[model samples]
Target: MSAFTESALLKKLSELNTSQQSIQTLSLWLIHHRKHHTIIVQTWQRELQNVAEPKKLTFMYLANDVIQNSKKKGPEYGKEFSNVLPKVFAHIGESCKSDKLLGSLGRILNIWQERGVYDAKTIADYRGRLHKESSSSAAGAAGAHPVAATGNGNGNGTTKTPSDKHSKVTDKSEKREKRKHEERLSKSKRSRTSHHATAATPIVEPAAPAAEPENGHTPPYLPLGEPPEPEELIKALNSIENSASSDALVRERIAKLPPEISEISCISKLEDKEKAKLLANQVNEAVDLLNDYNARLAAEMEQRTKLAAMLRDFQAEQKELLAQAEQRLDEHKKKLAKMLGLQKEIHDHLSNLPDLTQLPDVTGGLAPLPSAGDLFNTLH
Candidate 1:
């Protein structure tokens, strides 16, 4: 062991009333630290060769603890005293140094602070490089597209096909294509009318307005032209849904209009009292919708709860089954052990009997031993 490691071990031994096993373990650990320190010195001697001062101080601090703990027991612990003191002196001799060790520790601290030890300039540099590469990649991608030169379509950096480019080049070509497609579609549609048109009825356009009365007044009850096509109706609904502020402005304007003026407007023709009644009806409808939604949500939650409970019950049943299987396995093992013991006992009994063939030979051998010469020798 290095002097530093031996000293540390001695100090540790002094601190605690450790058992023999603990002492042995600590000795092994000390040897390991010495080996580690040797490796560290080999790699970092230039940087850390002068770190003896800090290491000495650290050792002293550890030693103090040991000495203090030793004082707690009476001085009659001679073996502990003998074992610790020589190691301590040896450690001090080997590791104690002044300027070199202190300077080394200061340099290490400065380097540690500057470098952040874990991740300082290295991380920042990596991040900067990554960002630069990403921006370059994005610019390259943007440059790859001819469409990027013009702000058409979705403005994504992608090239367009010649046909797609032609479509965008002039409205005349697009209109012509649309008209041709419509003509072809119309022909096919007329041919397959019975099959295709059966899914939905054909919409009938409203007739143009007839000449007004002699006073030039239009009828108040004219329909708004067949209530728009389904696609148009859907688009109108989407626009209304998307334009909440516009909807609110419209509603506000309707609400502020005079009764006669409101009555002239199609959407705001009702009196205040009638509007209030309509609003109350709407609120009631919303409440009913909310209640229905909540009821469905509650039913889903109850189903989830039931499923969780069933899962928990299944887990408990599985655990019980596993425990029963284990119990059965243990019982079988015990029975097998008992049967083995009985078999062993039976074998022992059978092996203890003498062979019948050996009995006569045994009797003859005993008779020859009773001869006169053998008897005289036996008497002596």
Candidate 2:
């Protein structure tokens, strides 16, 4: 039988024993022989299968050694076999620790060593071989040793040594120079386009001087003076009212008069004593209007401030409510997930039960109902 099948059978036998000590002893023997042998034979078979010629022959010789040693030890020896199992296991493990098989067994032994099943020295040896193989494979891929048959070299038909570092540096410098050249070209193109656009646009000059005023006609400047008597001013204002343009011009001329003249012109048609009384009444009315307007403005501003504060408060409350709503939604989703999980568990439990629809009713076999006196006696 193959080593794999033999190992599986031994494992099964060890599982059959119930005593802790017996199980341990049997397990130790099985592990030393079948378990270790299975690993070595599998490793040898894989390595030898791909090689041609002498390498294959070497693998066969190694495999033969393991098989012969296992046979000489005898298969299926009982408790007496335990005495020599460790030494044989160690020898087989060392044979498999070669660089050829290290990759396959390195990680495996490291795990075993971590679990206290293998020694530290064996684990380190296997790991070291794996590292060496990785480095060698990397060197081969990088074309470190070019063969004469491949003809990979300089154009002059001479084989060249690898210089990866120099090639990498040259590539980087070329990329940087290319980028800088592209930037300079782009900036020059932008500047040329802007200059052409400016040259194409039309420039507008200022308009010619306005036509000179005719006949040296200068506008008459009003002279500041005391206002005319009320009766005279009233007559003058009435005469100008007939012409719209003359009336506007007259009003403008009057505004340039002294402040006292302006006030007198406002009340020009009234008598002196009557005008004084009217002026006092007008002052009181203006004061009342100003006070009322100020009061209304203050109230409106206070209302606006209150409304703005209320709006801010409402926005804060809305945010709180939204947060509460999100929390509730999360809680509901959790509850729904839990309910679904519970429903699935219930469904599985019911599915396992026998079909109750096909069963006969046994309710008729139940004892008859007792009276109140029987119930009292049973309780007593």
Candidate 3:
């Protein structure tokens, strides 16, 4: 189990039969394997989503067991458990949150604190959400935790607590205040810079450029009206390629432009028209490259799919061959036993037969019952 890699564990889990026993086996395997907690949790969570109700329940129970077990390992293990809690909660979703679930989470957090690992932000967020849900669903507008406003030390509110609404409002106001503070700070800095610049030097202005198109859109790099020179097109491609904000899609569109430019630039005395044709050729080459990439990707995916199928088939064939071999060995043993018995019977019959010497010589010339060795030589 300690030697099991993430990929190996995932493959093992995928090959297992869908049964309660297998689920438990996987759970125990996970518990025993302490490394790759993140990978293990992700794989389990994904599989848990598509599983049946019984399996889902089993996984939930397994997660709880892991958490409980981690408690005994002390704080170091508890931190691992704490890291796993978020993924489990995400898998369970809002529907699975209960007092028991919260209590379990709370216990893990407490363990973490005891072990000297003390960040409970995730649990606190979950607890807040849980309280909100409980308050909304209950028959009375009762708060689950705080009923101090009702003048009772015990936490049982008959009416909706203003605290819940107040908290939401406070959060929004805090955000607004923070944003305003940042804006004020930025303005003050700008004002200070302007004051220093005004004292040091005079501000100069530059002429405005020509107006843009009526629609505020620029024409394409190679306009439809006329063919552009190869140099201009290559320059445009370089600008697009080197621009920081250019996305993958844009880069892909001009992928082959650079190489084409280099190749064309190396040739002497080429006409603009010829260069334009080469540019088109390069565009087609880029498209072909893209198609090839896609084809290779598809082929690799198909190979993987076929390999998995072949592996399963090979395992099945191996089992069948082993069973057949066992059966054949059993048949051989039975035949050997039967042959031994027949040989013993023949020996006994030969020994029981009366010696030919004791019989009044049936054939006068025949050697007396030819000793066993002489009979073998005569037969050969």
lDDT of 3 by residue, 58-155 (tens): 45445543444344333343466456556555544444433333333343333334334445675555445534443454423453653454563335
Poorly placed runs, candidate 2 (over 4 Å): 1-271, 344-348, 360-380
User: What's the TM-score of every candidate structure?
Assistant: 0.18, 0.24, 0.26
C-alpha-based local distance difference test score of model 1: 0.39
Best by TM-score: 3
Give Cα-based local distance difference scores for all models: 0.39, 0.42, 0.49
> Model 3: which ten-residue window has the lowest total lDDT?
219-228
Residue 97 displacement in candidate 2 (angstroms): 65
Ranking by lDDT: 3, 2, 1
Please give the RMSD to the true structure for each candidate, in Å: 33.0, 38.5, 25.0
**What tens digits encode model 2's per-residue C-alpha lDDT throughout 1-380?**
11335456434442432232332333333434654544434433444444443243233323222222234244432222333333333433333323223322332333335443336875455444434433344456556564454567556554544434333333344345345444544665565445333533222111111111237743111111112334644554454445333345545644454444336566666668976786767666555655565455444443343333344434443454465578678988999999999999999999999998887886689667999999999999
TM-score of 3: 0.26
Off by over 4 Å in 3: 1-24, 52-54, 70-77, 90-380
| C-alpha-based local distance difference test score of model 3 | 0.49
